[model samples]
Target chain A: MKYINHEELLKMEPQYRVQVINSLSGFKSANLIGTRDENNINNLAIFSSVFHLGASPALVGFISRPDSVDRHTLRNIQQIGQFTINQVNADFWQAAHQTSARYSDGECEFKQTGLTPHFIDNSDAPFVKESQLKYALKLNEIVPIRLNNTLLVIGEITDILCDKAAIKADGYIDIESLNTVMVSGLDSYHTSKRLSRLSYAKPGILPTKISLDGKS
Target chain B: MKYINHEELLKMEPQYRVQVINSLSGFKSANLIGTRDENNINNLAIFSSVFHLGASPALVGFISRPDSVDRHTLRNIQQIGQFTINQVNADFWQAAHQTSARYSDGECEFKQTGLTPHFIDNSDAPFVKESQLKYALKLNEIVPIRLNNTLLVIGEITDILCDKAAIKADGYIDIESLNTVMVSGLDSYHTSKRLSRLSYAKPGILPTKISLDGKS
Candidate 1:
């Protein structure tokens, strides 16, 4: 086993520290955040930090570095009050990954990466047409993490588009069957194989593998 | 494809909405958070909401619903200001998931789930002995998301313990090689297969596959 103390971690090469620290959190969601400015220029950026915040209001949150390449995304979300979170799948993950590249101001990642941007329901933000599972969100809040000057961009899920076959009888979406990929560290992409969906946990009762149809 | 608008989502059965909304975030890290009260009572809980907040200063954040079964974990961290995040692996993911069972107050999840807690370096928190990669952290800040009444508990990495061979030359840990599992929705667990590690993205230049050793 290797043990790295805080001091050693701080002193390691900067890039190395980033990879190590980022990977420490384990696997992350792979999603392309789509947005558009008032000028109607579309923007797309791949984000691995997207997380489920709550379900009652159907909130989603993703970390945004205001000073990073994501500034356009953060800016557009603020300007338009709408954006899309599209899952990065196995088929177009390369193009999805390419969206992270630092594009020039006003440049459209959808155009640069050849991913089609589709609009629906008078929404201001564009959606990646290739994404198998995607959703539209209305900007709800931008809470700053003062420690690092990063913003926690929270949004309310207002709409969703997914393959009907993926939604099970009990509401579990079989994302693995849709080929939605995951990410780790700064660059690695992966696909998953379901191990099991155990039954609702309760004390003194061991959880048994539950099928997607709600059968245990 | 099926479309679910905001109204339809709001009208969903609460449990069904929870499952559907939770799965929309794509895959999530599966982790066992270990904490201990001032009286030395250990607490273990499964958390899939953990996310990477920042790389510099080595920050990690996880959402905690103040009213949920995770109150034990939140209370323990408040009392001790230290906690450990352990990566759930395929070998013991079922045991890890079992930690989420709501035991009565002061009941140690470690004992309830039969998962051993290992302590080191005078730390108040315990590390799961079964975890292949784990790290100790110091509580930095607790930011409340007033929108949902959930708290984002931020912590700084203080120490790390992992298998020596998993750390690649460029510092990206091969977590898949360690068999670390991922979670989706609430109960489903997954193991990953590497697709590819792409090179750093650059505008107008396509990203190519990079090897574990950092060679493209």
Candidate 2:
């Protein structure tokens, strides 16, 4: 057993956890691809942590490291007050992850990753053309966590672009079919599998299986 | 490609996607167990999501969910203004998950799961006797996340208590020897495996042997 203070906790090595909450939701690979500032033209990165915070108002967020690194994605989101989150399935991971490089602010990751960037009206960000489950979000608020230089960036999901049938009657996104990957401890990625579903689940209750792998 | 509004975006069926955050970085499965509330007299079921939230004033949080059916955990925390979070090792999961059942208030899960409960000073919540890691968190603030009626409960960690030697010089806890289990998805649990220890992992470079899974 061990106990330590805040300073001690900070001393721990940072885990290189990879993948985000995107793409694993099926449809297509390359869930997010966007350009950096207009002048610097930097290339951004791809991740799966993009999550829906709420539905009524439509909000989304992704966690990122603090200012220690000049991340282009956060910069673009801050400067334009908007950015696009593309969808990536099994097909686009190679291209999507390619965006993780630290390109000059003037370089466009969209071009380097070989992804097509298209713009939508009434929005400041561009969308990924290849992603089947794409959307645009306007930066709403940046809630800085007290953690060691980590920020929980929350964004309002302004527009969602996806297949109508891909949605369910109960209002849940079916993402297992897209051959999505999940993030594990520090840089490890794993292909996700649908285990089960529940309107409500408790222990000892025979949990019924409704394979969420998108096969259905 | 499909673009939809709020109603349409939520129309998609929710899928079970689990990713490891490397947050529970202590001796796995250690906690102080204690009963909570007068009405929900049942033993309070708790788990570790222990991660750093802040440092200067000392803030931390654990990710806790409402009891699948009746919301015991949330109610307990809400009613008493305090509850202890206990750890379950690679061995405690069966009993830990068992506590998820809808036991009547006053029903002790400690009794049901065979876990020994130990009380602390001036506190009614008893710490789990068997856990290798345990800590007490005063009610700071609870942020309810609106995700598919699921709440991502965030608690401001006030005071943390652990075994001193559990932490190593590299600034990480040597929790692997404690035989703690990590959760993925819903029911899947795994033990710690040290693939490699990195020297200094920045954006482009990472420590070696973090995990052999791939492209780490």
Candidate 3:
């Protein structure tokens, strides 16, 4: 493999680089933003850049660049103090895509794209009216990355909203029943489906047997 | 969206939890791990559990259960003081999967899987022989997640090793071209391909332009 420096790495142009990141974050499906009118005026768009930060506080974040001036999503998050991460399902991929358009600062994506906005109960945050899963994050910290203009927006998962019925008794999130959109970088969409559930194990260890068929 | 409790969330098993995490970590794309193995017990494994921790020290980590009864990969890092992270690609997925096998404590996954092992000048941790990108990581604090028996293995990424050709001029890693596999949930896999890349902005903000055309 060829090891390149930052100078050489940054020479690839915006479009090419975005494609690579998009591939990393895109492909699976789509998602939409669920923000309040006041905040939507600040202008927020959702990209597949969104990813799970950790489970302790149930943190999640997405990468965003400046509106055009090239500020950074971390900046807006700092201003907002709180932001809602709404899961995109098949139902809202298109509307979510529309939100991606660089709209004016004062524009309301909900009205323009027709995705309904629902205020969450636990927090004073707006949510995707139809999103089956939503998260209210209290901005924790915005960590910049090694790569050129990228930043990791970390947050404290203050509140989690989900379609409880979709959550399995065993704690499995049954997004498959809801058929939500799974996104990669961009231009791709997927539905939630179960393939095979692997049995748990530690490396080089055998699971204890409760009973050997006929032998106790 | 329905909100569930921590008890209900914890009830979910690790097997299922891992899959959910894989999906969340950009669905398990390959990354490069590079280090020297002074112990001579070359350890190389592809983890969908691997993720970008705080980028400040350029940290990244992957969670692994004990190799055997009480053998822990984390413990190895703690004792050895170093390790490498290798990004997975189509070229090495099959071989990488083999490393996931529960090998005996003394066994080298590189030998057991027949995957080549390579090392760099700086460290003693061996990297996956076929990974296109690799990194040298110094052991950092390990935080045990409050959940069942899982751990948040944290490492500080000190140096990066990559194939310059795979890196784009825009600081983007063209992982799809590198043929990396993305994981969702436990066993599901998604092959990455070029999609769309967009700048970050609030919803309905102007100056929206897609960076990548159809082809990258």
Candidate 4:
């Protein structure tokens, strides 16, 4: 086993440290955050930080880097009060990765990456037409992390569009069936195979794998 | 495709809603957070919410549910000011999942789950001996999300232990080699295969997959 202390980690190169620390947390959710500027110019960027914050209110949150520089996604959310989160799949992960490039404010990533954007039910933000699973979120709150100067943008789920067949009876979406991709660090991509789904844990009982067809 | 509006989503059964919303975000990192109470009683709980916050200071954050019920993990972190995040792998994910059961405050989940607890460099918190990758964190700041009454606990990386062979020259850890399992919703587990790792994106140039052996 390799052991690294704080002092050693701090002395590493900046880019190397970023790769190490980012991948250290393990696999992250891969999604493209879609937003539109005041002129209705669409902007999309790949984000791996989005996580489920709460279920009752259906809240989700993602970390936005410092606002010292231009952040079109954050700016658009603040202005339009809405955005979309589309899961990145195998078919479009490369084009989705290209959205991370520093494009000019007026340029739309959707057009540049050849990803079609469509507005659903007159949504304020655009959704990726190629994404199999996507949802729209209304801006709920933004909490500032003074420790790192980053912002935690929280949103409430307002709408969802998904393949109905992928949803199980108990409401678990079979991601493996959707071919949704998972990301590691800043560049690595992966596709997963279901290992098993276990029954709810109890004190003395051992958990057994439950079937995907809603059988325990 | 299935379209679910906000009203419909709000009307679903609570457990079904949890399963749907939790899996809606796609794959999540599987980790076991280790903390010790004031009396040095160790506690371990499975969490899928850990996400990377920043790299400069090597910070990470996880959400703690509302304090309406007993939350030993949050309480221990507040009292001891330190904790360990251990990645969940195939060998012991069942035991790790069992940690989610509500154990009494004084009871140690580590012992009950059949996981060995070991201290490194006399660290305040105990780490899972069965885990291949683990890190110790010192409490940095606690930010309350008033929207849902949840708390986001931030921590700074202080120590790391991992299998050296899994780390690449560019600092990306090959999670496939580590056999780390990812979680979807509350119970599903998965193992992943590497798709590809792309080069950094630039304005006009297309990114090509880089080999793990340092060849582009």
Candidate 5:
């Protein structure tokens, strides 16, 4: 095993340190966050930091850096108060990754990556047409992490659109069936193989594998 | 395609809604957080909400519900001001999931789940002995998500221990090669296959596959 103490980590080259620190968090969701500015310009950027916050309110949160390529996304979401999160799949991950490229405020990543912008009646934000699972979110809160100057943007799900076949009877969306990709560090993409869904854990009993369908 | 509006989502049964909403966040990192209370009780809980916060100060953050099984983890971290985040690998995901069982205050999940507790001189928190990639962290900040009543606990990395073979030339840890598993919809565990590591995206240039060696 390799051991890196705090001082050693701090001494690492900037680029090397970034990769190491980013990858340390393990696999992250690969989602393209879609937003439209007040000017109606569509913005799409890949994010691996999105995580579930709550279920009853259907809240989701993602970290945004004020100064990175994500600045456009952060700015757009604030201006419109709504955004879309679309899962990146195997078919369009390359184009999805390209959305992270730094583009000027006037540019649209959809056009640059040849991905189509999708519109819905309820929200101004655009969704990725290539995404099998997508949702619309209205900004609920922006909490600043003064420690690192990053913002944790929380949003409430307002609308969800997905392929009907992916939803199981019990409400689990078969993302593996949809070829959804996961990300590691800053640049690596991966597709997963299911290792079975375990049954609910209880203090005295071990959990067994449950069926994908609701019948279990 | 199936469309679910916010009203319809809110009307679903709680069990169904929880599963659906959790899945909508897409794949999440599977990590077991280890902490010890002042009474010397070790607490281990599986968390899917951990995400990378920043790279320079080597920050990481994860969500903890004050009322859920995570309360033990939250309380322990607040007491000791330190904890460990261990990547849940394929071989022990079942056991990792078991750690989520609602064990009592005196009950140690490490004992209940049969996962060994490892200790080093610098911190009192226990690391999972079976994890190939594990790191120690000191509590940085605890931001309250007032909307959901959940807490976002931030930590700064202090020590990292990993299999040296998993580290690439440029410092990207090959998590897939380390057999780390991802979680979806609370119970479903997954092992990933690397699609590719892509070059940094540029406005007009498409990202190409970069070798693991980082020589490109």
Candidate 6:
């Protein structure tokens, strides 16, 4: 086994530390967040920090890097109060990854990456057409982390669009069927195979694997 | 494609809605958070909301359910300011998942779930012996999300222990090598296969897949 203490971690090279610390948390959800500026110039960026915030209000949140430089996604969400989250699948993982590159404020990552800007039923934000699962969100709140200067942007799920076949009776969307990619750290991509979906856990009961056919 | 609007989503059954909305963001990291109360009573809980907050200071954050209920994890962190996050592997995921059950205060989930509590360097918190990757964190800050009533507890990484074989030369941990299982929604566990690790993305350079042999 290997061990790294706080002092040693702090002394590590900046980029090396970033890669280590980011990957330390394990796998992260990979998604492309799309927004449009006031002039409607579309912007897309890949974010792995997106996490489920709540369910009743269908809320989701993602951390935005420190606002030291221009952040088109945060600016657009603030201005329009709307954005879209598209799952990064194998088909567009590279293009989606490319969105992370520092592009100018006015530039459209969709055009640069060759991924289509998809408009779904008057959504103010664009969705990745290549994405099998996508949804639109309206900004609900922005909480600032004073420790790091990063903003945790919470949003209410406004609309969800997905292939009907991917949804199970219990509402689990089969991500593996969609080839949705999961990321470790900042650069590694992975495709997962569902090991099992266990039944709701209880105190003394051993969980039984739920069948993929939506039956116990 | 199937589309679910906000109104329809709001009207769905509560548990069903939770399942749907939780899985909507895609796969999430599965980890067991271990903490000890003032009485030295160990508490362990499964958390999927943990996300990387920053890398420079090695910070991580996870959402805690509204404080309306007694949260041992939050209370313990507030009291001791230290906790351990152990990655849930396929071997102990069920035991890890069982920690989610509503347990009375002072009851040790580590004992109840049949997971061993291993201490290292006289750390205050326990780490799951079955976990291949585990780390300790010191509570840094807790930011409350007013919109959702959830608290984002941020912690600075202090010490990390992992199998030497799991880390790559570039600092990315090979989660697949460790067989760390990812979770979807609330219960489904998954094992991932590396699709490819691409080099750092730049403006126009095509990403080349980096070799796993610790070389470019």
lDDT of 6 by residue, B1-216 (tens): 898987899899997788889888889999889999999999899999888989988899998985522289999999999999999998888888788887788678988889999888837998888899999998999888877688889999999999999888878788889999999877889999888888777777766788864356
Which 10-residue window in model 2 chain A sums to the lowest lDDT? A17-26
Per-residue accuracy of model 1 over B163-208 as CA lDDT, tens digit each: 9999999999999999999998888899999999999999999999
Docking class of 6: high
Candidate 4 regions exceeding 4 Å error are A67-70, B68-70
RMSD list, candidates in order: 0.8, 8.2, 7.0, 1.4, 0.8, 1.6
Better of 2 and 5 by lDDT: 5
- Please give, for residues A97-189, the per-residue lDDT of candidate 6 as tens digits: 888778777678888899998897757999988999999999999888888888989999999999899888888888889999999987889
DockQ of 4: 0.83
User: What lDDT would candidate 5 get against the real structure?
Assistant: 0.94
**CAPRI tier of model 2:** incorrect
**lDDT string, candidate 3, A1-216, tens digits:** 564333433454566544443443213334443444334553346655565555544555555544332232344466667777777776766667667665655666677777777765565557777777766667776654433345556655655577767655444455555656555444444453333233333454432222111111
Worst 10 residues of 6 chain B by lDDT: B63-72
Each candidate's fnat, in order? 0.83, 0.16, 0.21, 0.77, 0.85, 0.77
| Local accuracy by lDDT, each model | 0.93, 0.48, 0.53, 0.89, 0.94, 0.87
Clashing pairs in 1: none
TM-score of 4: 0.97
lDDT of 4: 0.89
Best by DockQ: 5
Per-residue lDDT of candidate 5, residues A1-216 (tens digit): 899988899999999998899899999999999999888889999999999999978999999999999999999998999999999999999999999899999999999999999898999999999999999999999999999899999999999999999999899999999999999988999999999999899998998999997455
Angstrom error at residue A157, model 3:
2.8
lDDT by residue for model 2 (A66-87), tens: 5533367777778878776665
Collision pairs in model 4: none
- Which is the better candidate, 1 or 4, if ranked by lDDT? 1
When only chain A is evaluated, what TM-score does every model earn?
Answer: 0.99, 0.73, 0.76, 0.97, 0.98, 0.96
